[model samples]
Target: MIVVGIIGRPDSPWCHDATACLVVDGRVVVALEQERLSRRRFAPGEGPEETLRLLLAEQGLRPSDVDAIGYAWADATPEIARRVDSALPCGVLGTDRLTETVFPTLAAELRNKEIFFFDHHLCHAAQTYWFNPHRDADVLVADGTGGAGSTSLFRVRDGRFELLDRYSPLWSIGIFYEAAAFYAGLGWDAAGKLMGLSSYGRPSGRRFMTFDDGAGEFRLDPALRGLPSGGFTEERLAHEWTAIFEASAFPYAAGASNTFDYATFATDVQETVEDVGMALARRLRRRSGHDALLVAGGVALNAHLNRRLALESGYRRVSSTTAPHDGGAAIGAGLLAASVLGEPVRRRDPADPLPIFLGPAVGTAAIEAALDAESVPRQALEPEKLRAQVAEALDRGEIVAWFDGPIEVGPRALGARSLLSSPRSRTTLDRLNVIKGRAAWRPAALALTGAGFDAIDIEPAVAGLTEYMLCVHRVGERDWDRVATGVHVDGTTRAQHVADGSEFGALLGAVGRVSGLPGLINTSLNLRGRPMVLTPAHAVELFAEAPEVDLLVMPPYLVRRP
Candidate 1:
């Protein structure tokens, strides 16, 4: 049976989601976010209408072919969550709302097909475990607000999940971090930037946050909760954090002093998250008696904490997918619907997980069409010659926009839709960030061949499982200069180990052969504040806009600025 899974639309322009997924025969055949097609950063109030239409048409099936529908969120969001002043229109839908707007005729035809509403945190857990290699493990999910609360812990034994404990939104460490992001003036999506900035400052003795080990809950200082109730908005969050900061001994700073202050705040928050998460993982590991751990949620996106947990959690194995955030919930929702319908879920081996090349594929014809439509000058070369040209361009310190195969599934580029550059240059990071219009502090990652891991200080177990750009590893002193451009201020780098024999791996190998560099500095192929480019048209348009970008590698065609 074919099951379609979807996430609720973003409430406003600055928010994210509106991801549509189609899981056919228990495998996610297609998943796309509305922002990619709409060209708006996390396009608000948009449903999956266009994404669903394209995915179905590609498979020669219509909406009527779907047997069931699954929603990533639970039946309803908490009423307090509705009080926030969302920056965009609120057309985000759940299963009930979906039945009204998506595919009128298909709704009538598939009247017997059941509509399933998976709990939000459960969806996060399912996404991690269903495709995870571990058969029995402890699953931990931490996010901002989901249904009744924030944090959830579950024990998965032989393909089933048993809830061990849960915490309400009041104890949400994720929300606390979001407030910290707002305090840094980086906004909501800047959690990553917060993590990077943390490297620049030492942990402070503010002691405003703590975790209760016995209770297994987060305890925030009462002063941090500036709002009367739990209602949170960007403005409110900023105000609340400001009050807390003002009360501190080293109050808010002005001008350049603000950067140091923000960095200190980021460092304290990072340390707090680490302290709480590690304690929780250790306790859960002992209680569940599981050797492996599967983690999800937006907070799971913290690669630094992930690397630390992999080493210290006491579990023999730890696993997390690249899309641990809400976008991945579509995968979980799809798998859950498949189980309810009795379809066989794909069981990958513990060591060999599923490949994440799940986005829409672009063909040679489509590339040519986009180039022709845009009136861009281009060169067409054979595969081997094109690889050689790209490698040579990288060696010369030119940033190349590389597009190939299906786009990656998660927030990371993962070599599918990535910007490739020489990692040896000290200034490459700054230049790339400028070209992408991102803050200088946001870190770009590296795509390394397997052999390159030997140069970095990564644990054997963690390095062996480094398919996605999820965990951070310290760059060895000897190899620091080689990948310096991609390494963050903390001497750590989030690297995606390219698998042998894949097209992307071949390109990385070629770059290594030419420049003797450990890996290529790889980042998402889009400007800052934009979702990864979807179609060749989007890539072509981006190419036209960024003159600093040297070349656009679209399979057989390569376009250089005229």
Candidate 2:
């Protein structure tokens, strides 16, 4: 069966992170986010039409070839539809337009193919659990509001999912963190930034949020839920959060000149999240009696919390998919559709890592065409020679834009489309943040081979989490000077473990030969506030725009700025 999964509603303010994926015979063929093609961050107020069409065309399959379609939202219910309508701004269509107009129009366009609507949190759970290697494990899904609630727990035994516990949106930990982000002068989407900033301050003794393990309750103020009011405006939430924080003796940091004042607040929020997450995982473990845990949803993206869960949650094993956020819901939707259609879900081998480079791969002809179109000075070198030259350039403190193979599907850059530089100096980190239009305090990730782990203090049980840079590890005191640039303010580094046989691994080996270090700082290759480069032309365009990037490497052809 060929199933197509989509996540988004056309022109819906509450809907974002539009994405689409294709699954053929229970295997993921391609997954793409609309933001990447639309060149808009999160692709707010957009639909998945373009992304769905691209996936069909890329696979050489026509509309008739698709067996069914899956939507990430359960729009058929009156409650969800009413919620969506209330969140829309003035002059927008009501919920009737969705079931009476939009979905029907979609079905007609696709030759009357059956469309399946799934619960939002179920999509997250299905997506993460289906792709994971664990067959019987406890699953946790936590995000902003979903159809039923914000947080959900499930137990999977031999491909069957049993709902264990769920929490209402009012008790959402995701919204609590989002409110903390807003109070710290960062936007709602700046949860990653808040996580990074938390490292700079020590946690206060007070806890803003707590969880009861026995009662399975997530405690927080309901006024700080930050849900959409009558319209798609944040003013109401802003006022409510401001009043609540002020009442608690924690004034808003709207105009604070020193960010340090909010640092403690950020740290407290981070700790609260960790504490609650651990509580949830432990409770789930006891309820389900499972040794392995699979985590999904937006909150699963927190590396520190993930690291702590892996170490202290008592789940012998913890794993998460590369795209655990809403963008990944598309993949989950596809998998769920395939399961409903009587297709057996393919189980991943326990020994191998999950395949993340699932996007389209650019060919040599396309790379050469892009280079010729730019008319830049270039040199064609053999694979070995290219690696050596790129290593030497990086050792000389120069940045290289590495574009090869398929693009990564998740938020991380990985090695497919990344800007790489030697992690030998703090100056390199500062320069990279400037080029990427990020704050100077943000830290970069280190990409290295299996041997690189010997230089750091990492637990063997949690090593799998480092493969996709999903968790952070403490930098050994002795090797602190070696990877100072990649280490964050808290002395932890988010490391990406590269396979020994991949092209990126060979390049790291060459760098190790040249500089005695097997790792380099790796970050996404994109213009500021834009999605990562998708095509060879996009890579070339970024090379032309970012003057600080010294070399552009697209295997077999290396281009240098004139």
Candidate 3:
């Protein structure tokens, strides 16, 4: 059976989205996010039409070949925009036109495929449990808002999912963090900025939100209680967030003030969120009597908090998939819909539940064509010679744009699509930030072979998620200086472990043989705020634009700007 799952609704105020998964006979054949195809970061307010079209064309399939289509939202009602002439990506269709005309056209375009809608939170839960290695585990789904609620806890056993509890959107941890991000003088989408900034300062003694795990309750200041439940205009959310922070006794730095005070606030918010997350994990573990835990939702992307849960929280195993965010929701929606229809669900290997190569693979021919089209200088080398050249480039502190195989599905760049530099170089971090147009404070991840773990101190809990770069783990104090370029201010590193015998492992091995350190600083292969380079053309474009990139490696081919 061919099952295609899509995330995001045509009528809903969500557009920088839409991810699709094509499953055949219980196995995922392809998974692609709309943002990659649209060349828009997050591609808000856009449906997966372009993405689906591209995937189908690439796979030699047609819409008529699909058995069932699953949408991520259930009963997602469209809302009237409070303001006219809005250019918000989520409101691209003009909220008024969505329900009346847009969605109908979208539904009709699917032709004869049967459509199924799954609850938003159910999809989040499914994203974790369905493909998770643990057959029976406690699952936590926390996000801005799902169809049922913002936060959901579930227990899974023998392929059966039981909801243990849910928290209303009014008490959503995700929204609170978003508010914190807004108050930090950043866009709501830049919550990860606040997380990164949190590492630079010590915690302030004040708390902006409170959580009572024993009672299963959480609250923002009572003064902000009047904010709409499950929905809020950006203007309203921003205004209320400013007012709440200003009115509270909490210590907030001047909006235009020094970095120390801003970082202090960031630290406070980060520490508080982690505290609540840990408490929730403890409660879930006790209630479900399960040793393993699977975390899903946008909040799961907070590497800092995920690290805390992995190391400090008392769970035997804590793991999350590559697409823990909404992009992964499409895969979950398909799996859940398949199960509801009595189809066998393909369980991902626990050790490697989601393959690193889920996205489209660009072949050497494609790379050659792109290089030729661009009229760029290049050379073709044997496999060993190519690895040596790339590794030697890194050893000389040159930034190498590495496009090995299929693109990575999630936000983080695994080995497949990465910009690599010597992690030991002190100035490499700053140069990388400049290359990607990222904030100087944002930290890069370290990609290494499995043996790379020997040089670092990784807690057992965090060890589980090393493959996907889901959790942050503290670098050994002794090794901190060795991998300083990849270590955050807090002495933590978001690391991706390359499995032995993989092509990436061999590359890291080459680097290790030369440098004695089996790792390099790896960031997503794209410009700052840009979607990852999805095609050879995209990679060539980025290589041409990023002057700091010294070499562009497309396997047997290499391109260097004169």
Candidate 4:
């Protein structure tokens, strides 16, 4: 049965359902992003016409080929939520109103296939468990709030997934980090900026607030609904977030404070997060008596936290997928739909060698057309040639925008949709951010390649699992001078270790061979305050807008001419 799982919120820009995966005959097929074909970023509200068309055409799937449709979002968000009255500062947005848009759409789409509506958090839990390696792992769900729960906890037992608890998007860990990003004066959807910033400073009671007076725990806090009526305006959120930052961690040093807070704060933040995580991990470990813990949520992006949870937490095992955020929920919704229909569940172990090539694969023709349209210089660099040239650019300190392969599913730059450059020079770092029109202080990331990580001084667990640039790595003593600009103020670097032959790997080899640096300063291919560049057109427009970007490597073609 061709079951398409979709996840698009009401009033959101595009229908995310088109990218939904269907579990068929024990194989994971069907992972599409609405934007790739439609050429929009998070195109919410719009139908998945292009996706359905492309699916049917590319896979020889007809409309009738679809047996069922599963929505990642709740049919009615309210019906699923446990009415969170009196929200916390960063709690879920409007936990009170159910997303009523699900029903009418499901009913409409059902004419072609059986439509299934799932509770939002349940979908998140499904993602947690589906990606979990352990059969009976406890589940943790985290995201920007789905009606009520921005972050939630769950447990998997006896072939079933269950929720342990729920938390609102407000006072939410996601929002807290988000607020920190904003406080650092970064752009929207730029939590990475906070991670980068956190690398520069020590957590001096400024960026953290205790849950209890001296609980040593921190939460994104704001005023709750003091009245019987429960509702808070966006203005209120902005006001409260502003207050918290003013009262707490707003550094006022014009003398150029250490840009290394990310290390200390990330370390402290990771440690503090581990404190909460360890408490929860211990509780779940004791309650379930199962060694494995499955965590899903945007917070899962905290690699430093993840390392602590995996190494220090009480759980015997920890599992999270490369795409554990909202995007992966599309996969979960499909899995759930398959399960509910009495279809046999075939689990894909996260350990079974899963590389996150989840989104639509752009055709070479499309890429060529884009290159031709831009009249950019063209040449397919053989592995060695490209490597040497790219290395030369890096050694010379050029900011190159790298877009290769299928776009990664989640909200990370990864190596697929990254910008590359020199991390060694303060001038290069400043130029890159200025090119991005982002905060001048924001640090760039490094995409390492091969097994040469030991040669570069960095904290353990960082250079190893940097396949995705999710976690912050501690820069070691020797590499500090080289990666100073790339390393956050706190001395941590978000690194993506690329395998030897992949696009990222090749790029790394090139840079390493030339400059003796494993990778370039990495960042997404997007302007500040925008989503990553999703297509050739996006790349073209972006380069046109920001002329300083020296080159764009789209494989077989490079864009350097205006």
Candidate 5:
């Protein structure tokens, strides 16, 4: 069945914030994000133009040839916004002209095919639990907000998602940290930056939180003295967070700097995050009563907390898809539709789940075209040989864009769409930060081969399979001093685990053979505020505009600015 799934956000932080994914003939295709088309990260202001094109081309069929178009949207989206806007509380939603207008661009494609809508939270959970490599796993969905839900619990057995329950995001761990991060002066929506900074902190635990059992909720308590859970009121939190830290020894923005005091302050924040995470763990267990736990959502982005939850909860295994955020909804919505259509779900394990490199990939001609357009030096080497050459460059302390196969799903830079550099190069780290217009202190991920595990104290690749580089794991004492560029201040690294059979496995093996270290630090292929590039033309535009790039190794082609 030729099925297409698209998920969008109306008030997304970024524009053209739409992602289109397709499942065609047992192949998971169309990894294109709307941001690629508009050159905007999370493009919400635009429609899915390139997305529509890629889907059409992948099937060699026009829009009319598609079987169905599935959509995932926040429940009560327009009404929620209005209700939240006018201080009105609601249960069942009423008419919403604003949202129906947003009815999504899929309506444009659905004229000839069946149009279906998947619940927002359901879509998120489906992405991680239903479509993830682990079926029948305990499921948890957490994100900034899912319109109707901030978090949800579910059970999947025999190709079905049994709804367990949901909780409002107010006790919203995502919003709590987001507010703390913002108040900490770490740019807005840049909680990852704070996470990287957390290792430097000492976890003083002065800022204790309380769980309101009577109300079945949590709050920063003293800081949250006057507020009621009206559902993630950042305004209320802005004042509360400011008061708490100011009341504490740390100044309001003291956590922003990389100092002993700031690190200590980060410890407080980490403690707060952990406490909240643990509390959620307790609540989740009570709600589901299932041994397995599946967690997806922005809050799940807190690796330390996820580790804590895993250790504390009765659940033996905690599985989360790489993109727990709304981004994965495209994949989830696809699964929902596919399953309904009687498509077989794959549980072959993470090493080979759906071949998630479902986005756009450039052919030799596309790469060569980019090289010629940029007037950069060019050549074609066999991919295996090119891998060796690239590994050699990384060993020699070079930074190159490994613009390989199909783009990755979600936010992790899974090999295909990565900027490669020597893990040990401090200079490269600093330069890379400046290059990406982000923070150097924010660590890059070390993409390592399976064999490399013994050389260093790599975390159990199974405990953390961030082959997409989403979760953060501590760097082993043996490897920390070596992979300096990849290690956060806390001596932790976000490692994207790759296996030998995978396409990225070749690059890892090649790097291991040449560097003897078995890993290369990798970050996203795009610069700050930009989406990962999708086409050779997209790459050319970025290479011309990108300031930190030194070379682009798009297989069978090379591009280096003059």
Candidate 6:
């Protein structure tokens, strides 16, 4: 069966991160995010038409060739629907708009094919559970708000999902974090910045959220909730938090000179999130009697929380997908449709649990054309020589922009699209942050080979989490000096372990030969406000704009400043 899964709703304020994917039989044929092609961040208020068209064109598929279509929202159960209708404000669900507008438009474009709408949280759950190697596990989905609510727990036995517990949007950890982000003068999408700032301050023991162990429920403080309303927005929540904080013992002003107070607030929020996440994971393990845990949704993007759960959640194994946020829901929607139509869901090989480098590949001709258009001086070298030269440049404390193979599908750069720097010097980190237009406190991640994993102090069981840099692991005190650039103030590093035979792994090996460390500080190859580069032209544009980048490595061709 051929299935296509889609996300996003046109003109909907709540719908963002538009994406689409095509599944043939049981394997993913192609997946693309609208933001990558549209050159927009999150592709707000956009539809998946561009991405859907590209997915079909890549596989030489027509609208008539697809057997089923799956949408990532508006198919909740009757009970879920009722809860959403009662608890959420008008225009928040978007079910009516999807049915009356979006679905009909899609059907007309696709030759009136059968369209399947999936429960929002179910799609998130399916995206993680179906793609992972585990046969049975407890899945947790937490995001801003889904069709039913914000948080859900499910038990997956064999290939089916059973909902165990769910919470209303009133008790959302995502919203709590967003409020904190706004209060700290960071935007709603700045959760990552808030997380990084947490490392600089000690937790003050002030609680914004709490969990009930016996009931397995999380509660938001009434003070943060402000006035009781049907729904919530970041602006309203931020205002609520502001009033509460202003009346507290330490009143917070937006542009206050005291940086420590802001850091303290971030630390408190981060600790609270970790504590609630731990409680939820323990509850899921006990209720489902499962040894493995699968996490999805936006909150799963928190590497620190993921690390704590992996180490302390009482699960033998824990895993999260590279695209755990809404963009990943497209994959899950397709897999769910395939299963519903009596097709067996695809299971990845245990050895290669994540095959997420699913974007379009760049051909050598494209690279050559891009270079010629810029009239830049470049050289084409053999693979061995290219690696040697690039490794030497990195060893000399120069930064390189590495773009190879298909574009990565998620928020992370991974190995396919990255900025490379030597980890031996703290100055390298400073230079990288400047080049990428990021805050100085924002730490960079590391890409290493299997051998480099042994050099760091990390739990063996959580090795799977490191494959996509989804979890942070402690660096041994002894080896801290070796990878000083990658280690954060908290002594933890988010790392990715690449295969020995891959192009990136070969580069890391070459670097080891020169620098004695088999890793490089890896970050996305885009500026702070831009999306990762999708095509060779995009890569060349970034290289030209960021003069600080010493080398542009596009596999066989090496381009340097004239």
Q: How do the predictions measure up, each by TM-score?
A: 0.90, 0.91, 0.91, 0.79, 0.86, 0.92
Candidate 5, residues 340-403, lDDT tens digits: the string is 5567756546555544576765577777766677576666788787888877877877778777
lDDT of 4: 0.61
Error of 1 at 223 (Å): 8.5
Off by over 4 Å in 1: 9-15, 77-98, 101-113, 221-242, 253-257, 350-353, 455-465
* Poorly placed runs, candidate 2 (over 4 Å): 76-109, 221-239, 249-251, 351-353, 457-463
Give per-residue CA lDDT, model 2, range 1-562, as digits (tens).
Answer: 8998878867566678988899999988899888888898998977777777777888888867888776787743334333322111111111322432333334445676666667777788888877878878888898877766778888888877778888876666777777777777776688888899889987766666678888998666454434334432233444455455645624454535665678888898899889989999988988998998888998988899999999899888898878988988888878887777778877677665457888866789999889889787789999999999999999999999999888888898888899999988888777788789988887778887877776566433264467778898878677778888888899888878887787788999899889987799999999789999888999999998889898999988899877
Worst 10 residues of 5 by lDDT: 83-92
Candidate 4 per-residue lDDT over residues 151-193, each given as its tens digit: 5667776557655566544545565556545544453455655
lDDT of 1 by residue, 1-562 (tens): 8998877543323335777788888887788776777777666666665677777877788677888887777544433222222111111223333454444444555454455666788888888887677778898898876666678888887777777878776666677777677667677657787888889987765556666756776666665534323575434544565566555524353223365667777788888888888877876876787988888998888888788788888888888886787878877888877876688787566565355777777788898889889788889899888998999998988989998978877788887889888988867676788889877767778778776666566444273236778888777677677777877788888878887678888888788778875478898999977889888988988888888899999888888767
Instruction: Return the top candidate by TM-score.
Output: 6
lDDT of each: 0.74, 0.78, 0.75, 0.61, 0.66, 0.79
Question: Per-residue lDDT tens digits of candidate 6, residues 415-517?
Answer: 8889999988888888899988887877778787887777566444265577778888788788888898988999888778777777788999999888887
- Residue 511 alpha-carbon offset, candidate 3, angstroms: 0.6
Worst 10 residues of 2 by lDDT: 85-94
What ranking emerges by lDDT with the best candidate at the front?
6, 2, 3, 1, 5, 4
Clash pairs (backbone) in predicted model 6: none
lDDT of 3 at 344: 85
Model 5 spans with C-alpha error above 4 angstroms: 9-16, 25-27, 74-109, 112-114, 207-216, 223-225, 228-249, 253-262, 286-291, 310-312, 340-354, 546-548, 560-562
Model 2 TM-score, all chains together: 0.91
For model 3 the TM-score comes to 0.91
Best-to-worst TM-score order = 6, 2, 3, 1, 5, 4
